[model samples]
Structure formats: C-alpha cells, structure tokens
Target: MDYMTLKEASEKWGISSRQVNYYCVEGRIPGAVKIAGVWLIPKDAEKPIDGRRKNIL
Candidate 1:
C-alpha cells in the first residue's frame, strides 16, 4: 500500500495540515499510522466525512 505524508494528504484533500492531523488523531482516517512521530496516511484512503451538524427545517 502506498503511503503519503500529512502534508501530501492535506494538499491532495484540499484541507489544512492541522485538520488532517486532527482527523488522524481522532481515528477518522482508517489505515493511518504514526511512526517516528510522523503520520503516514494511505494514498488511497478516502477523505473522511465532515462531522458538522446541519439544521433542516
């Protein structure tokens, strides 16, 4: 499996690196592993769904 750094994932996902780190820490991204204090995310891993709540009338 191909793995990418947090920065790469962030850029590919069009999100902030900090947000990617948060998602990894929160277990939102499957197959994401931290090694030697660095995050390795699978290149094929889909971006996690947003958790924001929406108001529907």
Candidate 2:
C-alpha cells in the first residue's frame, strides 16, 4: 500500500495542507493512518467533499 504525506495529498487534491489535516483529524478520509505524529494518506484515496461548501446542483 503506497502512502503519501499530507503535503502531497494537499497538492494532488488542490486544497490547503491544513484542510487535508483537518479531514484526517475528523476521520473523513478513509485508509488514513497516523505514524510518528505524521498523517499518511493513501495515494489512491479519493478527496473528501467539503461539507462546509454548499453543493448547488
């Protein structure tokens, strides 16, 4: 299982690094694990939708 750091995930997801951390902290991101105080997100993990933003369809 290939894992990426928060910084890499943030860049790939086109969101702020802090936001990625927030998702990890909230358990919104699946397959996310914390090791040595560092969050390692799966490279293939889908980006979580922002609940704070309204989805106008």
Winner by lDDT:
2
Task: State the lDDT of candidate 2 residue by residue for 1-57, as single tens digits.
Answer: 999999999999999999999999999999999999999999999999899899789
Q: What are the runs in model 1 whose C-alpha is more than 4 Å off?
A: 53-57
Steric clash pairs (candidate 1): none
Q: How well is each residue in 1-57 modelled by candidate 1, as lDDT tens digits? A: 999999999999999999999999999999999999999999999998768856569
lDDT of 2: 0.97
Q: What is the lDDT of residue 1 in candidate 2?
A: 99
The 0-to-1 C-alpha lDDT of every candidate, in the order given, reads 0.94, 0.97
> Where is model 2 more than 4 Å wrong at Cα?
none
lDDT value for candidate 1?
Answer: 0.94
Q: Per-prediction TM-score, please?
A: 0.88, 0.94
Task: Indicate the residue-level lDDT of 39 in model 1.
Answer: 97
